[model samples]
Target chain A: MTSTAAHSPFPSGRAVPTPVTGGRGGLLASVVGVAVGSVFFLFPIYWMLVTSVKPPSEWLTSPPVFIPDRLYFQNYTDALFNWGGLKGLVDSGVVAVSATAIGMVLGTFAAYSLARFRIGGTNLSFFILSLLFMPPVAIGIPMFLFWSALGLVDTYIALIVQYLTFTIPFIAWVMKGFFEDLPVDLEESALVNGASRLRAFVDIVLPNVRPALVATALLAFIFNWNEFSIAVLLSRGRVTTLPFILPTMMESHYVLWGDIAAMAAVGALPVVIIAFLLQRYLVRGLSFGAIRSE
Target chain B: MMATRRRPSRWSGGRRFALLTVAPATIILIVLSVFPLLYSLRLSFTDQQLLSLVPPRFVGLANYAQLLQDNLFWSSLGVAAAFALSVVTVQLGVGLALALALYRLPRYQQFIATLLLIPSILSSSVASFQWRSLFDYSSGPLNYFLGLLHLPLLSWTADPRLALPSLLLVDFWQWTPFVTLLLLAGLHALPASVFEAARVDGSSSWQILRYQTLPLLRRVIAITVILRLIGAFKVFDIIYVLTAGGPGSATESLAFYNYVQGFRYFSVGYSAAMSYVSVIIVIVLARVILRYMERPVGRPAADVPVAEAAV
Candidate 1:
């Protein structure tokens, strides 16, 4: 057997292997499998897009209007402008951007320290992210009371405060991984050149991690943007955001699919766009530095 | 670079900048995450409802005691355990299959990968509504399509037994893609030669997948499973939207139960107790999985020798 055909020991960093010979049958099966998997996987979002454009008459048709003859734009407008919808958009946007900024600021500092200072063991960074398992809902009751006590309930502060539960840890974890790939020599050279440590970090290290920062910020913001339970319980409808308000719209009998779809279309737009436009960074982030490590 | 040449004096900018950088994140983390976690633990022992102005009366373990006796508690635990295991198992299994299948493909890997990720990235709330609609009895195409096959039409959400499964199916659909994406990345990272050599030795695709692919994919699979399961255990919006934990409370996971106790009924103390019980359980489970998933390479403690001494 050829060396090219023999398995390489290295798992990652391989050139895309040439397609194996005479495996069309297996490859064909794989395509069918992906088709089957992706349909159920993607159908809901596809349905959301489809419904967002469907005429009102097709909303609950028995057989379903898998295709709609006329696309409507009214739902998008009404949902965005009517019934505090615009306010919801502003609120979600504010909370997301604020949380992302705060999380990145705090998280970057911690991550850079951990990376450069060699604060703990090599794996300490990984262990820090282990806290990811602790669900935010676990603290919902205490936080609800705590925020109420401080009279911070129903405010942007509450949203930011709540968002840190996940985002802080997330930002720190991802940035630490990104920082690991940086060589220590640059910082050392900067220190040797009489540049202060802070300057070296800001000038040299921070610039290189730009892509990871953007990825982490976008991801953290999206998580905050789409958060539901905390938004519902903490803010009530007074501080309601898209996720909170969308559920309320669903509970009513005369659920306007068009309006819901319209808002969802707009709500999901930023994230879907980010998920695609920043695919390289997003994929790297979602890989969470695991696949790359090998 | 190997050693601190100057001992970086205490008043030095390096020392202070490092300290300052560490402080903000640590402070926010403790205040936001750790403090609240402990407060919830404290409230678990006392009968403290938020709205009631009266000082929190020390109930001393009564909340935990109540949880032990609450039938709903046990039921939700059963539901939670079942949900977590089934969802994780099926997701990992199917995801691995899909990933291996995709790795064999000649082209469009990025497109295929993106489709796999789209499901998880969509708003969980909307997905829940769509699933609810898909399983709707009267006019849903799912039932209509199944009806033509001479199958008995059944109430998916309305039935107590079927409700959790209905929720699970939706979750499975959304998250399997996530596991696939993660695993595919792992598979793509794996060296191609191992499988090629296995084939040279006359190994079948099944043999290569089992011994060569699966073993190499183990660490990543373990990580993905733990991450996904943790999320599964906290499932909220989908269930809340789909069944509201109904059909006679059949679908209430610990999350749903905590929400009702804390938010709807305003039994703040009771909710706090449940919260602690859950946080402790989840944290313990997380630690256990983290330990098992990452045992030998957990070199943070091992790296402590040089770093702490330098400090």
Candidate 2:
């Protein structure tokens, strides 16, 4: 159902094409409907922004401050410095980046084998995709026991290793889809000309799917960065990711609404930017390649 | 034997390359995913406690037997089911409406869709916090708006009855856009010629949608539904932040209860049993969906020309 007429015969990384024409009266209603729906969807984000900048006095006003007349940078500074947001974000960054680097390299190769050679065929593909569906707690329990036994809990290595359970499979499955979409003519011809298998793949195949590689990596990074369940089980206080820190803030003597919002905004900003940048592949990535971008 | 031998010899180097490249990821998955699953499965049958000094002893079927009769288990399953069903249903309904609406405005579809990605793109923890302020009893914008309309102020996540619904609201806000995006893509893929033919035959817009558009959209809808179902079942982040399964366990999902058993109470054996159950349920659900999704998209009815059929 993802077909687009104008798609080039040779697969190049691009988004699904726009739809054909619409009926006459439906256009006006669509405008109004989408506009209203946008407000409903966007209001909470606006509220978060408003709360983040509201002064302490305006934080809990009965008539909620829709617009915080006076902007405050104190909340941002306090959350970043006094609270654990900065440290937590840094921890999250290290874990996500390192894990993604390893996962992409490993996954790209596995994906190549799966797509090109059809290794283990459907069963192997199913096994990998199923990992995405497995609830984290199932693995989290056993992982906790294993890591604790190794005395590796709360270390960056422990978190990075655990993250591979998700990232590797995710990248492998998504990238496999992209690889399959690519024609093998170029690689075969390169190999026939006496280029080594690895060379043919690295020199020809990799460049064609560059856009997909980046999109898959970013999506995998987001999953790692947003992880909460495994982090909650594995980390005590030593290795706090941004998501893990928010709950602790809520548990404090008094809930710091402004500070929490500030921290959340800080954590969410990067992914929001990436989400737009990779908008073409967003649906494909989120759906784990089930819905192709034509 | 001869065919297999010939196949390998034909691409001997390629075969070796495939094995070498695939080995690392396959090994990692085995260690991290397969090994842990097997360990957890073993743990489920044994009386193990992380905090205990006593060596673990196997107690086959005890934990599973207890789970069958456990009231808390039953209640939490009920909660999980209710939350999953309602959220999936509502999201699909609202999502279809919005997608159809957006389909009519091709000029602004991409722009609007991009903007709609914001909520889903945010981490669940951050999204939950955003909602936390919105559902606050005293200072929440929702209640404030209620007050302006002369309605009594209502506690959202604090009240026992309202708590789950409140969490549902947040899930709805965050995920409906995703459903819309998928369905809109499906809508776009429908052939324009089919719609034009139906229109020429004097069929109304609703008739064309009912007869032509929907049948072609079944595959996309199925994929979307299963994906959402799997996601709804695994919902933990928002529930953790928003309600913490509070107000006398009104919002305590099976996942949360499992977490409490495994992590907080350290009933390793019992928690592992629950985890196995959850995994089995998800595996079964996903298996069917995956097979359906993986099936080749053959010639859909829309591809058949309309003029020839009328003759």
Best by lDDT, which number?
A: 2
The prediction achieving the highest DockQ against the true structure is 2
For model 1, how does the per-residue alpha-carbon lDDT over B1-311 read when each residue is reduced to its tens digit?
Answer: 23233324322336567677877877777787778878877787888776788898889989889999999988988888999999999999898878766665535665667756876787787677677667868756678778889898878899988898888899988888878877765655555666567766887666766777667667667778877778888898888888888988899999889888888887878988888767777766666554432212212221111112222
Scored by CA lDDT, what does every candidate get? 0.72, 0.82
Off by over 4 Å in 2: A1-25, B1-13, B295-311
Which segments of model 1 are wrong by more than 4 Å?
Answer: A1-22, A120-131, B1-15, B52-55, B288-311
- Can you give the lDDT of residue B311 in candidate 1? 26
Tens-digit per-residue lDDT, A1-294, candidate 1: 112222444322124332222256766777788888778777777877888887778887877777788778777777888856788889989998898898899888888776556454434444456456666677888787789899889998898878886788778777876776676667778888988878988999899878778878888887888888778668866787887777878766776877887777777887777788666665446644443421
- Tell me how many residue pairs clash in candidate 1: 7
Write model 2 residue lDDT over B89-200, tens digit each, in one string.
Answer: 8999888888887766555466688799788878898899988889888888999889889999889999999999999999999999999988777775666666667766
**Alpha-carbon shift of residue B54 in model 2 (angstroms):** 2.7
Candidate 2's DockQ? 0.43
Candidate 2: which pairs clash? none
In angstroms, give how far residue B177 of model 2 lies from its true place: 0.9
Clashes of each: 7, 0
